[model samples]
Target chain A: MDLVNALVVFANFVLIPATAYGAQLALGALGVTLIYGILRFSNFAHGDTMAFGTMVTILCTWGLQALGVSFGPLPTALLALPIGIAATAALVLGTDRIVYRFYRRQKAQPTILVIVSLGVMFVMNGIVRLIIGVNDQNFSDGERFVITAREFKAATGLAEGLAIKTTQAVTVVAAIVVVAALFWFLQRTRTGKSMRAFSDNEDLALLSGINPDRVVQITWILAAALAAIAGVLYGLDKSFKPFTYFQLLLPIFAAAIVGGLGSPLGAIAGGFIIAFSEVFVTYAWKKVLGYALPDAWAPDTLVQLLSTDYKFAVSFTILIVVLLFMPTGLFRGKS
Target chain B: MNMRNLMLFAGVAILFVLTGILQSWNLSLSILNMALLSAIMALGVNIQWGYAGLFNTGVMGFTALGGLAVVLVAAQPVPEAWRAGGPGVLLALLVGAGVLAAAIALHKRMPRGRMRTITLLVVLTGGFFLFRALFDPNAEAIEAVNPATSGYMGGLGLPSLWAWPVGGVLAAAAAWGIGKTALGLRSDYLAIATLGIAEIIISVLKNEDWLARGVKNVISLPRPWPVPYEVDLQQDPRFLQVAAEWGFDPVTGSSILVKLLYGGLFVAVLLALIWLSERALNAPWGRMMRAIRDNEVAASAMGKDVTGRHLQVFVIGSAVIGIAGAMMTSMDTQLIPGTYNPLRFTFLVWVMVIVGGSGNNWGAVLGGLLVGWLWLIVESLGPIVMSGVTASMADGPLKAHLVDSAQHMRLLTLGIVLLLVLRFSPRGLIPEK
Candidate 1:
């Protein structure tokens, strides 16, 4: 096989999946970091929120499909995403009003708020599971792959074939658009600037006549939107399962922390870093290495650093390393 | 100890009695036994969160370690598997430890430059491969012994009761390591770090098949009590008379007796822990911990090693959880690694501690019993309520689906309970004195 073919194979297996996963994580991390910045607590319910949103989107997608609605080349889930975001935003805002507002008024410790979020996590997790039983749900209804492995192999006349899923491409593009919108809002828009001000210095922002509650409401709304998008993208790419989303909490938190808890840029950077590291470490690279190296240097084993089962371990390790060296994360935040 | 505490405890007793009346005593006793263990876990969490104000979200990890302890200390050893590669496994473990030590030493000794980094990486990279080379084959050989049942190298062939305290010790050791790295961070970071560590511990437990049989599970763990089995109790002369007097058959009576015996053991352990915790809480050390928790800056200014205190409490609390975990395994008579989820093992305990009372030992126990009982009751009640609600609906897939979805109501109820408690009684039911 040609070097181009080998590179394509490696990219297909490792790079593409990681990029898609990274985008999903980045969006999730952004929501996490935003909450951390504004709310002054690590929202433990983030994963569950994602799951809840995804569950809503799936339900909506099913409803739409039942009504004979389709997105042609794109997944029907994409059409249902905005509705999902709206439902999620309402859910989050309602939770904040009922559960979190009391704590905020009490001026309770961040730990207490964290505990409250855990409560929210349970509620959201339960609601998601209740609405859509705890089995995997596939909602993607479109072309499965942008380029199939067989088609690529036929075109390239190579032994190795490269396949890219449509969902993966959608995830990356949606993530970019979301990140761009978020940054522009934060830097160039009125509400976004007010949020940054509040995040930077809550008291000063309050003194400047910024409605703290308004900023908080907007933050939750934005976070809910991001969480919904990320959740749907992930569900489209991989099957949607409630427990898997809960498990995603660790890696998402890792990404947010490694990027710096309240820094958007850091969260994005950390997401890619965590995703790539997890993918690369667990990946068996022997085939790609064999193709890249000379015939004399072809390896016998899989040449994997760690098994795929230890993917969580990879993210944990990276998180610990980051926490040890740069506790503020790669990008600085209030902490 | 006081009248209010007594009343609160009486309330719990009334609930238990209600459960016994509504359900069978056997089921109630099972709930009680689990509540007793959960109280121990809540006590552990209380020690950390209440006494030291440390946010530890890694209860599942410590609990898993406790489970691991059972497997290591009690299970019947697979001699053939051990003989096949036991030394190799031991040597591999040693190499791994040595590599870590050497790398740390090299980093500290060598100048903070590229040479030091390169040397450390080289040592680590080479050691990992070497260790794996030695470990993987032995692990495969050990796992290959009896793939269906005892593929893993079993425990030390000791009485399983020994595993309880040993589990505590093992968990304490893990906690100490975790605390060393994590205790210095902010509360949120510490929470995330502990969570990550817990995940790592679980991954190890689930993936390392040679050690604990992984997902295949290690069943028939030895119990501390010598209570007769249901069948044997039916044959027993004394038990038959007792069962006859109680107006019950042998099987049910025997099961209740076994559960009661286990409950007795658990109660003894719980009392001992509470006594120790109470003593500690009232003493100068406990006061110091509360002082540190309340105002770390002032405590540190007064020359207290804040992180050290946090670490101490963290280890002690985790050890208590570890003991409870081991006890839980003994109760189940099996070590199922897959069953340890954060929602069940970790967060539920937090709710227990919080709903019980954060700083009070009695509050934790009361909360544990209350939440544990509710958790069980809600699970059963959800379907009943759902069926009742959906009864009016026509018999179709929609109605059937609604009834099926009711199982999830337990978690929602738990969340609502926790939120309500936090909202109305921020100090919990049995507030700290």
Candidate 2:
């Protein structure tokens, strides 16, 4: 069926890839939102934090591969993720103690904190580059694809085939697990409740004997863990490059803000929105149209709204639009 | 000036002199020129952040636009490319502008209803397709004209110096648009918006080949007037005689002379800007801006136009950055869009402003010269330093990596310096009096 073929083409190009990308963005946004909620700053260093986590994970993955260890059907990166998260947590905790604690003690303005984070970003960026160099490193060494295009075509007897990469599947699954655990921790746990209370009213929470330092520490650790998992999953899905992770800051910020900064549910929604918009705008829909349309009615041109190069522009435009209409964001987390 | 300020400036001068004594005068002069430019950039940022407390992270974008201005205003025209598709491209741009204007007008005039939304979408979609149809074909034709060199519609072949102000105007226009949209929002929002806009501006520069030949680069741009080429100076008999009298080789004399001329011009510009900025800072308007920055709510209560002042300062600052960017491109004699990155253009300038002393004009100049000199010195010294550190180590991949990654040491050092200053002094080298 031509319609089935069209649907398959749409799923392959737009739906599946966007979902995977959205999951990565959601994980990234979750980290950013958590920081904004608890730390009370946007954390300009978040992208570099992700890069640092990914760098540690990558080094661990390489070490594992050298030791003849792998996850078999999944990437070896999965086995190395926990070590990455732990290392990232340590790094972030150290950074807070050294650089951010002074500012926190000063009770500096959020804008000042943002500038301080820029300094941290530079240092983290340097560390990543020094360790891994500026070149792309591919660490996805196990199964390449869950469903090969040829196999899909043979099974479906359709003109278009739907192929899903193993990384994409893993990204979606890992993201769901992470999000569920995070929600559960936030909703049910005492530390999570304390964090929520602190975020809600810092003075009131302090008055209620909630340890501000502990809340801050837990926030950093959770944020670091999320950043590490997101970074490793993203690196697996695409490729590990420090500059690309740095660039991802724009979209991640866009996602966090659009979802309403400091709102977990909003962050996930914002990520999907940004991812879908970027993919839909940049994707050439000529083939899908050709499959669905009557023979003579098929369009002549590639129906891409914008070039792939302008994908950053798409996310930026969405951010600007959201900022213009809803300064507090979709879920009204904070102004 | 105070004794401390005088000593700081003297220290910067000594550093340059040391560079001249230790390295070649040519290298020292080159560094001086870049430092002068960096000072201008720092002063621009100081105007926004110091005077108005606006956090603009799009300095790279404004600087890149300034570079674009040089190519658009000074480069030799590619007649064939223009003849191929120039008019169509212009028309397409006009149509696009008209569409946006119409949409704005419709939004203002139309009542809030579904009909308005439908009409707006219809107009936008139709205009986009029409614009694309015209733009794509013409751009392709222009790009096809030579495809090797001169594949883009080039400039008016004006004097290169003219591009400096044109660059300011271009950047000012962009800043106006951005400030109009993003000003009056939360401070961090402005920072994020500016960051995103900077990236978009760079992507435009990289992809729009029909404008400036994209990544292929536009080379051999005419130098600003009165700075003669070294070869021309070398060929002059009087110059050669003068060089001989000075006990210098003609080639070396000419190169040094060219750099000196450039340095003189740059110093003139820097002095003029410093004078102007100092005057402005002492003016009543400057007092009002500082007052507004210290407490926006209070300033608003006093009937000051907070957003308007911010937008004004943002534009002025961006214009200054744009001028510096144009000067840089003219000095380089080429426009390489790929080389424009935030680390070099944006955050580095922020460091200079912060390190120099935010609210003081002289402090910015000091910060610029010191940081610029330190940046270059660190770059040259990094490999040597790394090699020295690794000299006692065994020959292995670790040693090799340490040596190879020495270039990245500058970033780490810069970050450390920023953190140290922020933690210790917070007000930078020369605190605001």
Each prediction's TM-score against the native?
0.98, 0.99
* iRMS values for every prediction: 1.0, 0.7
lDDT by residue (A87-165, candidate 1, tens digit) is 9999999999888998898899999999999999999998988888899999998889999999999997888888889
Candidate 2 lDDT tens digits, A64-156: 999999898999999999999999999999999999999999999998899899999989999999989999999898989999999999997
lDDT for B248 in candidate 2 is 96
Q: What tens-digit string does per-residue lDDT give for candidate 2 at B64-164?
A: 99999999999999999989999999999999999989988998899989999899999988999999999999999999998987899999999999999
Model 2 alpha-carbon miss at residue A9, Å: 1.0
Best by TM-score: 2
Best by DockQ: 2
Q: What is the TM-score of chain B in candidate 2?
A: 0.98
What residue pairs are clashing in model 1? none
**What are the runs in model 1 whose C-alpha is more than 4 Å off?**
B244-247
TM-score of chain A of each: 0.98, 0.99
Query: In candidate 2 chain B, where is summed lDDT lowest over 10 consecutive residues?
Result: B424-433
| DockQ list for all candidates | 0.80, 0.83
TM-score of chain B of each: 0.97, 0.98
- Scored by lDDT, model 1 comes in at 0.91
What value does the lDDT take at residue B239 in candidate 1?
A: 90
